[model samples]
Target chain A: MGRYFLSKLIQSLVLLFGVLFLVFMMVRVTGDPAALMLSRNASPEQLEALREEMGFNDPALVQFKHYITGAILGDFGNSLHFKTPALPLVLERLPATVQLASVGMLMAIIIGIPIGLVGGFTPGSVVDSIGRFLALIGQSVPNFWLGLMMILFLGVRLGWFPTFGRDSWNSVVMPAFVLGLPVMGQLVRLTRSAVLEIRGEDFIRTAHSKGLEPRTIYLKHVLRNVAIPLVSVIGVQFGYMLGGSIYIEAIFAWPGMGGLLAQSIGWRDFPLIQAIAVFTSLIVLLLNLLTDLAYSIIDPRIRYGR
Target chain B: MSIILQVKDLVTKFYTLDGVVNAVNGVSFELNEGETLAIVGESGSGKSVTMMSLLGLIPMPPGKIESGSASFNSEEGLCDLLQLSPEEMRDIRGGQIGFVFQDPISTLNPILTIGEQISETLIRHKGLSKEQAREQTIKLLSQVGIPDPELRYKAYPFQFSGGMRQRVVIAIAIACTPKIIIADEPTTALDVTVQAQIIELFKELRDALGVAVIWITHDLGVVAGIAERVLVMYGGRPVEIAQVMDIYKDPKHPYTLGLLRALPSLEAKESKRLKSIKGTPPDLLIPFKHCPFASRCDYAFDRCWEEIPPLISVGEQHQAACFFDLEEGGPRHD
Candidate 1:
């Protein structure tokens, strides 16, 4: 177990470095940061001073080395737009994004799993038909469009909920649903199919032959067996939720890292963008790691190097 | 001997896009207390389906029991199994009739430990408390000849070998001390040596507990060795029914004669080519108007083509479903 954990840690470090290199190269490859920073009407001397200050005058390798070392020492440069420490600014927005993703995931699991269970157990039933219909809608409808629809229906016309801005718990509802619905739909379908496949397995029949109630058989044997694959989907969905939340956050005015990152990208704030990119990658990687650890808990064979 | 379970003209059918396919057609049998009745058949011969239908294990909608009755004598009275509600069927399933399936690895849940699987049955059917169930589980495991039962109880299905996994399956099946145990090809997945061991285990359980066992298999040798009486099925219908020794010695039906001839016996002086049954079993679709075995039977005639033969008595305890009498000579092919 210790050796496994060490190997996983090394793999994570390599992934971190890979993300950093890709972000650095791709962000620079698009356009010159110096050109973006300097105003169109700026004097030549002023532009030159700003370029030198920002390390554009240095060799690319040398600048990369300095950036890596400084980042390691917890010294990401100040954001050009926010005029604040880039790391602090990113961290400040981290909680809100985490909260949104967490709530979205919670909603997906809470609602989607039961729907999937019912759908799978009774394939041709009305519940299954409804589940499939909802799943189709969820998969086809884009997140931004769903957000707009929720705002138009619930916020504008019905006046049942707030349209935009994260002011209270009630405000988180629309954005979370908009972000989570697609994921929930996907999960429901995945879970339904997984459970259906599991139900056909001989072990499930054995469980039934044991005189176990249908609900008990479902909860204890069927769900536990299906959870391994479901966990992987959940992990991937979680990362997508973090990354995909930007559109919903922007539309709903949610104060998450997604909204903050979008604003930084619009302004071409290099430090803030880099910080947010690294932060999001780290979060996604960590979630995947946690998912790997959880596999062992779900199935003991996985713990013994499966 | 008093009959404990009786199946009368049971017809199990499956509805597909094409039409309804008769899987088990008008199958009838009876099981007395403390008897071992083997239902022998090739693959897709409805041996498994007949047993599954009795327990109401066949999934509804796609698979349904179209007609006939499965009556069991219980405390309430003679109950028709087909008439029971799903809840009532559940009560009879694990409580009275235990089932051990072919593949042990698949039969036992991969995620749950052996102890939990066995104890779950005990708790559900026997109403044992958690601690009591655990104790009973260990006892049941030990009963099935599993060594260090207490320690092995915590082990998962994948941890055990094929024979040991079958033992775990047996332990779970017998946890409630069921009156009737249906072992559907229990040893089919194991090696020859392991198969003998499992077969011996069944005999030991039957002798010790006086439980009636319905051993379903395709192996004629196994039927000869373990079964008291044998029901030979072909094309979703019973071809012959007889005492084990009688079936082996004076097999009456053409299908049974073919099955016996197919077996390579060690007692033979010279090595001879074993007879193989010619042609496949007829398809169940299009409503089998003629006898199911007539196409494959060497003794088939014009009469065999037009009518379905009813099971007729040959000896005191032997029966065959064939129009031609085999008492004159061996069966003559047209």
Candidate 2:
């Protein structure tokens, strides 16, 4: 297990380099950073001064070398728009995004699993049909539109939840639902199909032959096997939730990295863009590692190099 | 020995998208206490379905127990298994009548530890606490020939080899000292040496526990190793029933003879080409009005195709469901 962890750590470190380089190159390619940042009324001399100050006049490779070296020393350069360290700016909103994303994923899991189980258990029954129908609607509807609908109805009309911004626990509900909806749909479908496939497995027959209670058979025998696939999906979906939170955060005015990213994109803040992209990709790589570890936990057959 | 189980006219069917499949057509057999009865048949002969139906393990929607009675002399007394509710069936299932399915790789739960899988049955049926179940499970592991009972108990199914997995499955089946163990092709998924070992292990467990065993397999060669009585099923019907020796020596049914001939024998001086039964098994979707094996039987005649043959006494303890008297070279009016 320790060996497996070490290998995965090495793998993630290599992947981190890939993320840093890709984001750096991507942000640079999207038009001139100085031109996008400076005012139109500024004279050529003023623009040149701004470009020289920001080192935008330097060759791309030279600038990348400076950025990479600075990044190694925990200096990702200041955000062009905020005029603060890009890494710190991204990290500041990290907790909010984490909070919203986790709460949303938790909500999806708490409700989706039981509903999916029931649907899978009965298959063609009424509950199964309804669960599948709701999952379909959840998957098809765009997250932004769903957020708007929730804000209009639950927040504006019903006064059940606040329309925009995160403050109280209740305030987080609308955006969290929007964030979790697609993931919840995926969970429902995967869980249902998993249950359907697993219940027919030879071991389940062995369980039934043993005369275990319906509840016990499902809980002990069925659920453990089902969890293997579901855990991996959850890890991946959670990563997706983090990246996809920008739209939800923007729509709801939630103060998170996603909101920072949205505002940064509008102002063409390349450093902030690079920092957020690198940070989220790192998180995704970590999530992939977690998912691999989870496989060994649920299925003994999966082994690392060791 | 007394009869432990008597399954009468077990007619199980499947409601398929194509049509109603006559899977098991009025099958009947009896298992004696402390005896090994092998049910031998080709695939889709409804051997597995028959066992599943008796255990109440058949899925109700597509597969249904159309009509049947499995009068098992369980700990709860002589109860008709078919008449029992799902809850009642559960009580007898792991308690009195344990079942080991085919395919060891798929039979044991991969995620669960061998100890947990084995002990869960003991907990449910014997009311043993976790510690007690764990203690007994380690003993069962040793009993089923799984080495290092203590360490192996904590191991998962994937950790074990195919033979070891089957041993774990056997341990679970015999966990509660069930009155009967139903092993459906337990060695089919295993290698030849492993298969022999599993059969040997099963024999040892059976002798030690003195529990009745219903060993289901398609291998006639396998039947020769462990079975006391052999029940030959063709197209979901028991075509012949007799002592293992009798079935092999004085085989009355043409299908049984064909099965025996299909097996290569080292005892024969000349290498005889192994005979293959001419036709495929009768389509289960069609309702059989006559003998199901009539089309395939070389000895099949007008009477064979005209009427459904019932199991009739051919010798003191042998029965055959056929119209022709192979020994006399004529169709028996009797």
Candidate 3:
């Protein structure tokens, strides 16, 4: 188990380097950072001064070396637009994004699992049909439009929830629902299929023949056994939620890293954009590692080097 | 000996998209106390389905129990298993009745510790405390011949060998000391040597606990060693029921005879080839109006194709669903 953990940790480091390289190259290739940062009214002298100040005049390899070294020390340089350290600026919005994503994922799991279990339990029943219908709408409908609809109905018309900005517990509901809907849909499909497949497994039959209560059988025998794959799905989904939060943040005006990302893109804040990208990728990579770890914990059948 | 379980007119069908398949058509059998009743049949003969149906373990909607009444002699009284509520049925399950499935690797949960899997039955059915159940699990494991029962208890199913895993399956089955254990081809996946050991273990557990077993298997050799009485199934119906030795010595049904002849007997001299029963089982999609084995049986006559034959007593405690009479040398349709 320790060997497995070590291997996964090493793999994560290699992946982090790969992500860093991709973010650096992708951000640099888009356009000149200095020209985008400076206003149109700025003179060539001002632009040159800004370029020199930001080390845009340096060779590409040299600039990359400097950026990589600074990133190692947790310094992603100053944002051209925000005029603050890019890393800290990204970190400042991390909690909000984390909050929204976690709550959204929790909502997704809470709502999706029961529906999946029921749908899988009775594949052709009315409940299954309704679950499939809900999954279709959830996955097919654009989240932004759903956000708008949620805002229009529950916010503007019904006055049940606030339309924009995260403040109270109730305020996060709309954006979280919009973000979580797709995840819920995906989970419903994954879990239902997983459960359906698991239903034929001999262990499930053994559990049934043991005469356990329906609740015990579903939760203990079925749920935990299915959780290994489900954990990976959840981890991947959360990583997606973090990245996908950008649109939700834009629509709702939620002050999260996603919102920061949108603003950085608009201002061509290369350092900030790269920082956010690197940070989000690292989070995704870490989550995958955690998912692997969770597998060993949930299912003893999964082993490392041994 | 008293009868422990009585299954009457148990009909199970699978409603697939293609059509409804009569998997087990009016199958009736009984399990007596301290005796092993082997349901012998080839694959798809509905032997496993009959056992699963009695436990109400068959999935509804797709796999439905059309009609059946399984009366089990519980401590409280005789309760009709088919008529009981799901909750009541659950109490009867694992508590009074246990099951050991084929493919022990798949039957045991891969995620759980051997102890956790075994102890659950004790906790659920026997009302044992956590500590008590843990102790009993180790004991059960040791009884099934698992080495280092204490350490092995914490190990997962995959950690054990196929035979050892089967022992764990047997341990789990016998945990609550259920009166009846329905083993569905429990040794099919094991090697011959391991199969012998598992068979021995079943006998040991049976004798020690006085538990009646309904052993489902296709191997006639296994039936000869373990079962007191044998039930031969073909095309979802019992073709013959007789004492184990009687069925082997004098098989009344042509299908039973074909099965016996298919075996490579050591007593017989070197032969050209092993004789196999001709034709496949009749498709269950069609209504079963005629004898299921008519097309496959060599002695099948005009009346065999026209009507179904009822199970009739040919001798004391011997029954065969056929119209042919060996002594009379002709079909006895009436």
Interface RMSD (Å), every candidate? 0.9, 0.9, 1.0
Interface RMSD of 3: 1.0
Q: Which stretches of candidate 3 lie over 4 Å from their true place?
A: A27-65, A122-127, A151-162, A166-170, A303-306, B14-17, B62-71, B77-79
lDDT of 3 by residue, B168-287 (tens): 888878887889988999999999999999999999999999999999999998898899999999888998999999999988898889998898888877665889998987898987
* lDDT ranking, high to low: 2, 3, 1
Chain B TM-score (each prediction, in order): 0.97, 0.98, 0.98
CAPRI-style quality class for the chain A–B interface of candidate 2: high
Of candidate 1 chain B, the 10-residue stretch with the lowest lDDT total is B325-334
**Residue B61 C-alpha lDDT in model 2:** 77
Tens digit of lDDT per residue, candidate 3, span A1-306?
A: 888889899999999998888887785676876777777788999989988997888999998899889888988888888788899988888888988898899999998878888998888889888988898888999998989988899999999998898877888888888889998998888889989888778898888877887788788888887776789999999998776388899999899999998888888788888898888988899898989899888877666233
Question: What digit string (tens of lDDT, one per residue) describes model 1 on residues A1-306?
Answer: 666666777899999999888877866677766777756787888878877888878899998898888777766688988788899988888778888888888988898888988898888799999988998888889889889989999999998789987776788788888788888898889989998999999988888777788889988999898898889889989987876377989999888898888898888788888888888888888988888788778987776555
Deviation of model 2 at A24, angstroms: 2.6
Residue B258 of candidate 3: its Cα lDDT? 93
Q: How high is each candidate's TM-score?
A: 0.92, 0.94, 0.91
lDDT of 2 by residue, B59-171 (tens): 88799988878899988689999999888989999888888878988888877788999999999989999999999999999988888999998887877788988888888
Query: Is candidate 1 or 3 superior in DockQ?
Result: 3
| DockQ agreement of candidate 2 with the native complex | 0.83
Q: Clashes in candidate 2: how many?
A: 0
The candidate scoring highest on DockQ is: 2
Q: Any runs in candidate 1 off by more than 4 Å, and if so which?
A: A1-7, A27-66, B75-78, B267-271, B330-334
